[model samples]
Target chain A: MPKILIVDDDPNIRQYLAALFEDHGYLTVVARDVAEALQTAQDERPDLITLDLDLPGEWGPRFYRALSQEPELKSTPIIVISAMPGSRYAIGNAVASFTKPFDREELLKTVGETLDL
Target chain B: MAKTVLLLEADSSHADALKIYLGRKQAEVHVAATDEKARGLLASRDFDILLGNPYGFGEACPGEVKRHKLANPLLQVIIFCPRALMDQAMDDFGPLAANYLDLPLNSKALGLALDHAEKCIATEKKLAAYSQRLSDLHDAQSLYQQLFNEVPCYITVQNKDLRITDTNAKFKRDFGHEVGGFCYEIYKHRSSPCPECPVAKTFYDGGSHGTEEVVTSKAGKQYNVITQTAPIKDENGQITQVMEMSTNITQIRQLQDHLSSLGLMLGSMSHGIKGMLTALDGSIYQLETGLQKEDRTRMAAACEQIKEMTERIKKMVLDILYYAKSRELQYALTDVRELAETVVSMISPQARHKGINLVTELEKDLGIIEMDPNWMQAALINFLDNAVDACLFDPKEKEHRVVFRVSPRDPETVCFVIEDNGTGMDRQTRETLFTLFFSSKGSQGTGLGLFIANHVVQQHGGSITIRSELGEGSRFEVCLPRVKTDHARLNAVPQPHQNVAF
Candidate 1:
């Protein structure tokens, strides 16, 4: 099964995305902010990661830069999810961008295509 | 100097004798043997003196003297008459007669009278010149007065101590006619001189300076004036006073403010609208996917999401509408205690969701107040919402609570107090809390909530005040009069671009 990482500040949004991916036969791990996302990415080495731009403390773009520096996680695909418009440029290596409240099927499809499901 | 004289004598011997005697004294004499000839000579040239024999001319001598005096008021007349008629001729001519000499033909007396007549003529010419000069000076003084009073600007002369030494008619009528009053006291009602005052600068540098200031009249009317100040120096070149000239520019400032406010409204609303559209897109995606899968439960969830998002969009649209709409207020009598309870109940659900307690301590006898219910409710809700948001944003590990209290502040005023033990604002945020488009909450706030709330309170002829310190809490007090008056409504109408404080 493909393992996925969800990074969002809102608990409801994180839970909903996790359930959507788990229902598609993928193992999902959730992180509330940039710090938790970085810790989870290093530990789980997920196939794909969903990032939210507006986070507490360090933001999603800063986390993306730090995550890109990690040699083991450099190849992992990142899908940008934000409430901010035109936030696709937040991460240069983002596979796709989704604005909240995001399209459930579109997000699932993007994740599947990124992980080659 | 040769003096010109008109001699009216019916006897040629007497005329020739006087003429020969006057000729030796450098006199140019014209002798008329008849009354008609004397009238003809008087009309032909301006004579310095008229030496006439009234006995020869009969009763017409007084009439001729009156005519000549009317033509040239400075023309001196000497009437040679019998001693019995001397008093009568003097009475008829009044001040026009220089002398009434008895006609005995004494050459020495005649010579003395001629010299006296010449002296009178010289004095009359000097008096006429002095009268003309005086009238000219009067005209110049009147023109100066008109320029000072009727120039359509406020003019004030202040001494070195900032006391108003003099003011023009326009300044007296618009401000007050109080001389020897402090300029700041009369102009702005301030106890001290304003900081960096233009008048003070002119006095310091002895140069002209200009600045824009808001001046208030004695009756509390405000005016935006562009004021220029210049020094009034003494004869020794020492600055003794400063002259302040101000032109009112309230209307132009109002137009500029209105335009900028419209721009601010447009710029601030764009982000929230974009977020709402994206949320609507999400709901549509859910509906389409649920329909494709043919799942009843998923379709029901999608319908609920659509309904929820639609409500949010409607609220956002109404918020914008409320900020932009300028409408007449509809006032009704309302109970203060009941109003406080209703506001607390309305916001209690959100407070409970965040594990925060919402409490109300309303006085029993708050009484009924005349106000617009809709606007008052909106303002109260905004305060409650802000209190809740402050709590939600606090990262402290403690329980949050908000108190809504209503009490009578005085005989005439009723106050609504909202206190929250949440994340308090710093001084900078508190200072600009009521200004347009100033928001502390990024993305989540439209920055119009408090501004509109303050507007609603002012519309009701009330005031709002805020007290906050960092990490402590915030207290908002809205004081309103118990009885509404027409004067209050008239005074409360928001002026365009006026920076209104609670």
Candidate 2:
């Protein structure tokens, strides 16, 4: 099963995303901020990362930049989910972007296409 | 222009010859043989010249003509008399007579005398017209000067050098009579001229220009003013100076700032609301899957998430509603002791959860006070909650405690003081604590609680006194009068926004 990492400060969002991915036969991990996201990404080596822009500490854009700086994590696929508008260009290298109250089926399709599952 | 001549010679033959000679020179001569006829002619019609021998009537003739001449300054008199009395004519008339001619008048001399008298008449008329014009100009200039001084706005006329050439009464009243001072120096206290100056723009284009600026008065009071400039031009249409008028719009701008800040808050809050809505969707998703998959743990967790999110949304909505309106205080007679106890009870549980000790000094028989119980309780709770947060922010390993004290300051007023041993705010935060959207807790604070609390307390004729240090702690004392009409109680209120030095 492909593994997914969910990055959001809100625990409810983390729980929901984890359950959604796990139910689709993908193993899941969660982190509340950029530091934890980086730590979990290094350890879990997830096939995909779902990032939220508005984090408590470092923002999602910083996490995306940090990914590029790490040679091993440079190829990780990032899907940006944010409540703030103009987040599409905030992380230009992300595979897809969705604002809050996102359509569930559409997000799942984009994930499947990015992972080619 | 025909000159009317009055011939008072007392010689009929001489009069006929004089009238004929004068008529040839465009002089309409009227014969006045006696003083009575001369006075009648002078009174009935305006005559340009009086040609007569004053000695013909002895002393009566010259004195009457002198009196008439004083009354009619433009009326010229030519005296013709017997050779013996020509000296007497000169003595009586003085320089007031136009000329003196001996009797048996030589036609050439008489003609010359009339010509000379006509010349005097024209010169005096020209002088009188000039004096009238000069007086009119003086009146007009003074009237305009009065208008300039009476204008309500601050007005300054600046020359090309940007030096004030003139200032109106209102300007002198506020900024002092700063004529010959540099515009920037007097108005803005700047060593150099302001950039993008409207006065300079007006002088360049000969067009009126306007800008809004914050200016300080001579008394050191600040004002928001809308300044406009117009070119003062010479007759050749060259812009020689610029007249700058500044209308004080401080009150209007202050009101607009308040309203705009409210709009700004709403705009910022919308983003937070969107995120909350998404979180709500996530909770709903969890609930739906839990029900579909027969998962009891997920269902219970989903229920708790929904409840918490609902509470957050409800609070935000209420905050928006409360902030949008300047609500009137709904006063009720309520026990003051119970009110303090109720607020302490709410803060006690949170204090314990955070390992912060809660201390209360609730005095006995505090008595009843008339106030809006709903908002007043919220205000007291807000202060206690802030005390807790201040303690939480202090990461130093030490005992943390919050003290809530309620007491009656006097017969007509009550006090609620909340003090905390926590990471207190600096002077900047303390000064702007009650202003719109001023938050010290970063993302954790909504910035609305203290502002709303301050407003509610003020509406109920209360005041908040703040005293805080950088690392020591903060103390917020709220003193509210027993009644809303307690205007005299303000004299007893403490000095506000006291910051600790160092």
Candidate 3:
């Protein structure tokens, strides 16, 4: 099973995504902010990352730049998830983008392709 | 035109001869044989020339001629007497009489005398018309001077050098500067002319120009003014000076600042709303799955999150509504204890969730207080909510506590005190907490909480005192007058108006 990292500031979003990924036979790890997101991404080395654009302190793109600078995690696919409508183009190299309350089936299809499953 | 002559001669033959001589010169002569008859003729009619012999009236003729000349300065008088009385006539009449002549008049002499008198009449008529015009010019000048002094706006006439040459009464009253003062120095207290001067623009283009400016008065008060400049031209149509008139618009700009900030506040608030809505969706998703799997833990947690999110949304909506409308307090007699209790209840659950102890001490009977109940409760809630947030943000390992105390300070005052044993403000934050535009989201979490809270307290005729120690705790005491404010009395009926942001 491929592992996924959930990065969001909201606890409820983290809980819901964790439960959904686990039930779908995928391993899941969660981080509350940019600092935690970077630490967990390095420690767990998840197969994929679902990134939220807005956070309490640093934005998600800043975390993406930091992650890409790491030689080992440079190629890890990133899926952009955000409530901001115009955030799709914020990270030019994003694998895919999904707005909040995105359709579960479509998100799953995009996630499946990104992981090559 | 023909000149009219009054002839006074005792010799009828000589008078007839004079009439024939005067007629050839286009003069209509009226003959009066006696002095009384001549006086009657002079009183009854207007004559351009008076030709008479002074000896016939016995010294009365010269005096009468002088009196008539004084009454009508434009009338010409000619005295005809024998060479014996010519000197006396000349002395008595002097410049009053136009010409003097000999009696037993030679045809050439009489003809020459009439011609001289007629010439004097024409010159006097021309002088009279010129003098009438001169008086009319004086009246017009005074009328324009009155208009220049009475206009309401601050008007100044500036020359090419931007020096104030003249000012209206209003300008002198407000600026109180001398006429030769520099326009910049008088209006703006600046050493040099302003970069975007409307007066200068008018001088350059010879067309009216308008601009808005913030100027300082002589009393050091600032005024927002809309200035308009028009070129003051000379008789040859050359622009000599520019007349600048400024109307004070401080009140209008102040109102606009309030409204403009309101517009800006709404745009920033939408981001917070979006985040909350996304969390709401997450909660709904959990609720749906909890019902599907029959998981008691998921259902309970989902319900709690939903309740908290909804409560926050409801509060934010109320805050928006409060700020959106015009700031007219709807005063009512409210139970003071109830109002305090309601605020505490709303805040206690948050304190509990954050692992902070919440305590309340209220007088048994706080009595009924006159205030806007809704605004009063919102203000108290903000203070208490800040206390809980302070406790949550504290890095100390020691226990945290928040105490809300309500009591009557006097017969006319009720007080509310919120104290927290949590992170306290530094020296800078303490000094500038109540200062307007004191926004730095460090000590006060929304940055607007304390600002709006202070405003609410002041609106209710109240004061707020803050005490805090860094790394220890903070306390806020709000003392409000128990009776309605004078603002409420004057605004018994609120006038509806467009509201703006500050």
Candidate 4:
């Protein structure tokens, strides 16, 4: 099964995405903060990562740096989710970008199409 | 205003001599040689002091002195007696006599007693007048309170510390249940005092101030209150208390909001439509020119753009109609979970295109919340739109998502929480979020979304709250009561409003 990693401080969002990915026949790992996301990346070596630009403590560039340094997860596709559609970080150098309250089908399609599912 | 002295001595020789001496000292002196004659004279005039001999006709004359006192209670009576009779007179007359002179009165002692008697008389007269005036003032104060309490405005008195000292009848009736409560707690519905208080300024300056403020009741209903506070002062010009009159202006504020919103709606619709028309016209011109030149590709593109612009205009018109009638919410019993799902589904496509997650956690077997589905959808869409706007940025944050969760809070109410992991609002933005005509989006915002949402929620006996922190994200919570309101019945005939996603 394809492995997907979800990073978000909100437990509800993290749990919901995990359930969504698991239901769709994928192995899902959820991380509530940036530190946890880095640890999960090292251990699980997920196929793709979904990252929230806003994590609890170490947010924005700090989390991005942590993700870029992981040798095992360096080649893995990362999708950035943001509420601000016009923000500088929404789509800069990310594999895929989505706005909050995203369309479920399009998100799945992007993930499926990106991985050639 | 001339000082006068009346000597009531029955001894003819003593009376004549005393009269000559007092007259020489610039005092008008009248001598009566008999007690009966003196009593008759006293009945008709105002006297500064009355000098009398207690041994009138040698009849153990205590009765005559007492009678004189009864006639004029404030009369200063100085007894003149020979040294032999001085002790007897004092014992018999009690102390009604202010002082005594023995034998042949020394002119110096007599003159001093007369001056003392004049001062005593003046003080007594002034005190009597003052007492009468005070009684009259009390009557006037009671009458004024009656008039003040009868007015409709809420009146309250507070100390410099904002402690409620007293409240009038109207204030009592309006907020009597909250007596002895902190002024801010009772009036502003705040857990603590307001940060910026006009009452504080008024206290500092000893001046009157008027301002409009929003106050919340214990029941959580908000009121637009116009308050005026004036300093209550003492004779020394020190502010002892503050008199506050607050008038409920909630309805007036709502009307002003409605009118301004109506104006904004007209203004934006005209502006949007005009721009849409101009674009449509330009596209038409392009298509006509392309067709004339036999360029089929350009003509097709122009036609497509025109169609899109027209569709956009149509949507704008529908939004205006939806909000214009939001005051009258027609509602019915609707499944809360189903409604949330439907809204999520409708907005999912836009989210999917933007690559954001759309999710809903609807509790199963939840009872229905009565609300106007079309209006409610418009209101919810406002939150969804804000959520969408918060996440619409260049770097697609992977965890950018909005969640619509509904759970039964109680048998009579359902909790609907729509939280977005979008850019959360700051304190100031949250404060003015739902106020009519207050928008932070500048020209891009019509300021109608939250206002309309607030109105719709209020109509359905529900409440909407926004929780946000800067750079983190924002959450919108709406709690709807399960009991069907009259508004629900009116809106229940749901012909889906045009452009309403849910």
TM-score for all models, in order of appearance: 0.77, 0.68, 0.68, 0.48
RMSD (CA, Å), each prediction: 5.4, 8.1, 6.9, 14.4
The i-RMS of every model, in angstroms, reads: 4.5, 3.2, 5.3, 16.8
What DockQ does candidate 2 score? 0.43
lDDT, candidate 3, A14-40, per-residue tens: 777887777677899998678889999
Per-residue lDDT tens digits of candidate 2, residues B364-483? 879999888988998888889889878876746699999999899999889999999998888988999887676665334466889889978876768889999988999999998887
**What are the per-residue Cα lDDT tens digits for candidate 4 across B318-427?**
66766554334555778777788778877787677667787878888786776778878877877887787666531335589888788888898887788887767778
User: Please, what are the lDDT tens digits per residue for candidate 3 over residues B288-337?
Assistant: 88999998898888898898779777876766666655566778999998
In order, what lDDT does every prediction score?
0.80, 0.83, 0.80, 0.71
Q: Output the worst ten-in-a-row residue range by lDDT, candidate 3 chain B.
A: B437-446
> Over all chains combined, what TM-score does candidate 3 have?
0.68
Higher-scoring candidate on DockQ, 1 or 3:
3
TM-score of 1: 0.77
Docking class of 1: incorrect
Q: List the DockQ of the predictions in order.
A: 0.23, 0.43, 0.37, 0.02
User: Which is better, 2 or 4, measured by DockQ?
Assistant: 2
Q: Candidate 3 at residue B151, lDDT?
A: 81
Write candidate 4's Cα lDDT for A1-117 as tens digits: 889998765443454466456656889998866677888888998888887765544564576776677666667888875443543464356777866655556778888886774
- Could you say which candidate leads in DockQ? 2
Q: Best candidate, lDDT-wise?
A: 2
